[model samples]
Target: MLPELKDISNEEVKLPESSKVRLFIKREDRIHPFVSGNKYRKLKYNLIEAASLGFDTVLTFGGAYSNHIAAIASAGKLHHFKTIGVIRGDELRSKKDYNPTLKFAQAQGMKLHFISREVYKNKTAQTFLEELKRTFGSFYTVPEGGTNALAVKGCEEILKPEDSMFDYICCSVGTGGTLSGIINASKPHQHIFGFPALKGDFLSDIISKFAMKRNWELQTAYHFGGYAKINNELIEFMNRFKAENDIPLDPVYTGKMMFGIIDLIKKGYFPPQSNILAVHTGGLQGIEGMNLKLKKKNLPLII
Candidate 1:
């Protein structure tokens, strides 16, 4: 059976009278302890497809600290499938030879394959994939972040009409699969907004091209310091949002996107009466090492 949908409620966040926006956050973060939010959607069908094809192992790619890797490790353990994580970049030479993500993934029985940056960049090439097929013996290879057609199909479920009254849907964009899926599944009348956590250079065009259907609107102004980077304001906002709404957001991902959504609404991005929905794409574990980096940088804590 497919995983059960856990929580269902509209937690309203009130804005200033001038803003005239009422935001309701869909807590997909609470979906699962490890396989949470968009990760769940991304992996759901891919896992089933792999099993049906009689594949006993799944291999995927990601950075040193990737939510995708964590999810795959957890899902593999739960479903009795072996997992291999092809991590980019070499192991650190300076500091202690340890990364929390890598450690946890190893603990979960996920074999790690570290590759040089240049080699990692060729991950999309058919030749490289063929090499992996030969190296890893037989396995279903899922692209980095599970950003593929099947993943987009799974995220389409996120746009289902809510039983409650709401008019808009918003969420952070990583590889754009989640947004693409939601946009694909959303009703024509409903407005969909995607807050890109990356620089706007060519991400919009890239996502737009992928989403050839041209059914949704995507914005890229709130990346803050770009992917995997965080700032004091973002950290403070994350802490405050959690304190007020009991919703935790990771600074490197959902927190930044969320801060942008609220800022845009407050700046007249949306009408006052409009009801907005924001998705919480889970990446809590990714924050572990980044948080330590922040603390070491002597950045002020938001506690």
Candidate 2:
């Protein structure tokens, strides 16, 4: 498998006089023309392993507008693997009225299987995965958001010495996969932080068990109205931040992390001269679909 690494320049962003912080973005956002950022790192090892194990097809679970699904589909097509997306949502009665994300997945040749939210929760249940295996024949199964040991290995590659040394690294947590991977790969000197996008209290325990970081720090201040729900302030921040830096920030991932990071910096979370690295997990495709929803509600946008 040929791994493509994108070289991006670090931008030295200035903070307020009162804050006095120097911020540098690693630009994982520019990992690829389509499937970019942490998604590539998360999927690389898994894809290679699947191919090596002689798996001709790949099957995974995700929501109707999951970046994971988009990335998987994109990777499958690019890497010449058959793909199936067991999407979590009901099919619209109107056959022509398809969600944009589902449309994109289908366009990429991803066989779509709709499932109820209740049943979707059982994706990892032994019986369910076995049933899928029987139905689809032998195939590789990646958890939603590409969580696994292989995914963690891919994330570790992102922590090279050439990358800026950060006091703290922050990322949006979905299934606790990316954070868990980063934690496993990070040096003891660097700290890893997660902002849970879902409204659940048990994620800390999940992360603790996954990363073996019994004393790791977990913060829940920035769910911003739960999964996929965004308020005006978040929208405003995404727009303003993009305008100031010209960086694309989808509210679902990077936007929320940026909001939380800024709030943390303003609250004096970091001391003087301390650097922070915020991982930009890519979900830009969902932004187009989100805009369609927000536009109908007259919510303002930047891009």
Candidate 3:
């Protein structure tokens, strides 16, 4: 039998100074080492549907350090399904040993298929998918970042009956599946906030595709550049946040989100005395790979 998922808790974030509002982080990172946080939520139903559909092989796409790639590989291995990872950036094919995420996925028995950026951009094209089917044989397809109807269905489970007390719900947006789920599950009185890790105006449309309500807003200014881009200030904030809150945050997602929540609080972005619950969607597996880049750049690494 699979290990039973424990009750995920909300731990209060210790702000520097007491404010009118209280901030708590939903410890979704503790879900699993490889299949942690939103990745787990996003994949929960997709894997189930794959099994029900009689598929033994599952294929997905992601970049070098994607949490989704690592999580799916781990999940597939654990559940006895074959996994194929179509990794972006053909240049990374030779660097798997140095890339911790890729190395882990390989160790989990996922077959890594490297592709050029040009081809990856057209990954969803019918002809491209047909070519993949011809090359890899019949397999279940999970889109990059794992966003889909089933993914959103799983994410909707993130919020519980007890969580209705919170007036605000916050989560990091990648492909928008998790946020869409939260939006669907949220109480009418609660407001949902999405902090995008990537810089793009197109996310709104993606979210709209899955989201059923207009009770949420995207916090666009906190990306700190684009996806996978990080600076010293972000590194420092993540370190300090860990030191103070005793919570380790992934630089790409959770770290940026925590920074935004606090900054918004300080700027009076939320209504006074509003209760805020920030979802700590996990991507901690990518920290090791990010540190390698930080080392070469002579930058402070995420703690």
- Winner by TM-score: 3
Q: Which pairs of residues clash in candidate 3, taking residues 3 or more apart in a chain or in different chains?
A: none
Please give the distance, in angstroms, between residue 160's alpha carbon in candidate 3 and its true position after superposition.
Answer: 0.9
**Candidate 1 pairs with clashing backbones:** 20-272
Better of 2 and 3 by TM-score: 3
Ranking by TM-score: 3, 2, 1
Tens digit of lDDT per residue, candidate 1, span 48-76? 99989999999999887889998899889
- Candidate 3, after superposition: displacement of residue 52 in Å? 0.9
TM-score of each: 0.93, 0.93, 0.98
* Top lDDT prediction, candidate number: 3
- Give the true-structure RMSD of model 3: 1.1
**What is candidate 2's lDDT per residue for 1-303, written digit by digit as tens?**
536785655665456778766676667778875577778888999989999999989999888778888888888888888999997765531341357777777788788887777888888899998888888888899888887778777876666665537777777888777788778767677787888888878877766666855424667889987898897899898888887887878878788888988998898888887877777877788888788778889987547
Model 2 ranges off by over 4 Å: 92-97, 212-215
Per-residue lDDT, model 1, residue 221, is: 70
Model 1's lDDT to the true fold?
Answer: 0.80
Query: Which portions of model 3 show Cα errors greater than 4 Å?
Result: 1-4
